[model samples]
Target: MRRPHRVAVLLVDPVVGFDAAIAPTLFGAAEADGEPLYEVVTCSATGGQVASTNGFALVPQAGPEALDDADTVIVPGTRNAAVRRDGRLDDAVGAAVARIPATARTVSICTGAFVLAAAGLLDGRRATTHWRHADALRALHPAVDVDENVLFVDGGDILTSAGLAAGIDLCLHIIRRDHGGQVANAVARFCVVPPWREGSQAQFIEAPLPHDDSASTAATREWACAHLQEPLTIEQLAAHAGMSTRTFIRRFREETGQPPGVWMRSRRLDRARELLEARTLSIDEVARRSGLGSGANLRHHLRRGLGMSPTSYRKAFADREFTDA
Candidate 1:
């Protein structure tokens, strides 16, 4: 049997306690075939107790040496003076980050980007951090491209997310990347969270409902998901939500972080991908079910959205029954 993926989370001193908990909660909850898919280990610079916000301390299971064999390393947010005040990694932290193998993926949650930036891992690469620290990150490391709007930035092997709850979205995304939609969805279901929130979603949305029960486009969005195979137009959706077309467009964007048409296209593509992975459907059938009109149209969208053809995508992610032996 293939060994489970090893994940090492490095907790720096003066850590954001909430940020420190995300990785172990999310990745540790991901499972396949009734067993954990990732072996998550928390570590600190000295392999001992680390100070955190709120006057709490975390005792890690291991030390920086854990990075040496990890398949992925996560650096949670910290207010460590080295990275925050001086814009440099402390000697121990820098040395530990350097021990991460080149083949291993790196992730930073919130202000953890400061550590990565200080260590030069983000040079010339697009990254993000807490919006409050965006200006400072840019000023300190002028070489790193920082976008403060999105929930997360997936820079191939190096991923960075904005503050707090954005870490959940990033972790879910990584699960989807590693295990495909079905497994990721199962994990999300178990965790009682939404299965997919695109990385492009805004870090903040202005409109707020007093309660989830308040009148909103949520029900309409749910309806839309069920009918993705059918042709869905903004006007039709607007009418279903009992709002004017103009109002619908504005409200949908505010609620979902994407325009109506863009969100529909994304849902369709997502359905296409799930079908490709989980079913024996032909490309034509997948396209038809996903409301892409035809296999040709499906190929166009898949190529543009995922940068791969249907067959190739299936080969990479499909179950054995879906892909030829």
Candidate 2:
């Protein structure tokens, strides 16, 4: 009989509940052809009950002894200000983590990154946290490259995700990478979550504040939407918002996590994606309508953003049974 992949969730004391529950809810549900693929266990430092940040506590079925057989180890987030401030792993917790076999992989959900950091696992690695805590995470572990925008960063053996639900996204992503898109999509469907997210944690914003009390960037955004086919530039977008370019640029970035030009391009690409999925329009027409002006430009961005050509993207989204031949 084939062995199920063993996953150990290392529960540090005073764990944050939201972070601790994500692994079992996500990876534990993953299956293949009606067969359970992962066996998930919760373990504490001494192999007994662990207290939560809340008043309650949890009885871990396994102790650190479970780490001996783990194929993967996940450190769920903690709310302890000390961990958040200094990335300090209590001695017992640190030793248990260090005992994982060299072949075993590791992951952190939310502020669980602190545990990983304190264990010296995240040094020289890219990581993230709740955007609100990103700067402090960096201040504590300057050796770690902190990117607050991405939902997760996959560094082969070590993975770290941003806040809360992003842990779910990372688990699904790991499942997708280990199995396939079809399986991942199936799990997503069963869970009633989106089959996929853009993955990057960056927010998409039209404007920072209302143009006036009457409306937010609604009218100006709509106007920009209608004129995407034009050579829509920062100057044009600013003018449409009835503001100077400097103010418009600042507000746009503050809101969107991207500059006006980049957001416009992303908007254009989103429309292009819709057209491609529609499959009613020819590739050239899709380009023209999405403001790329040519199929070649559309192909370039589609390949860069979606990692596929327009034809392939259309097929994947529009028809599972799609074939170019």
Best by TM-score: 1
TM-score of 2: 0.66
Ten contiguous residues with the weakest lDDT in model 2: 316-325
lDDT of each residue in 38-152, candidate 1, tens digit only: 8999999888899998678999999999999999999999999979988998888888888999999999999999999999999999999988899999999999999988889
Candidate 2 residues lying further than 4 Å off, grouped into runs, are 80-82, 203-325
CA-lDDT, candidates in order: 0.88, 0.78
Can you give the lDDT of residue 266 in candidate 2? Answer: 73
User: Candidate 2 overall Cα lDDT vs. reference?
Assistant: 0.78
**TM-scores for every predicted model:** 0.93, 0.66
RMSD to native, candidate 1 = 2.5
In candidate 1, how many Å is residue 176 off? 1.1
Candidate 2, residues 1-325, lDDT tens digits: the string is 4577788999888887878888887777777667777799999888878888877888887989899989999989886555766568667787788788889989998888988887778899998776777888888899999988877888889998888888888888887656545666677887888555435636232325645643334456568767888888778777877778887777666554566677678768867876776679999999999998899999999899768999988777545322211
Q: Pull out the clashing pairs in model 1.
A: none
RMSD of each: 2.5, 6.7
Worst 10 residues of 1 by lDDT: 316-325
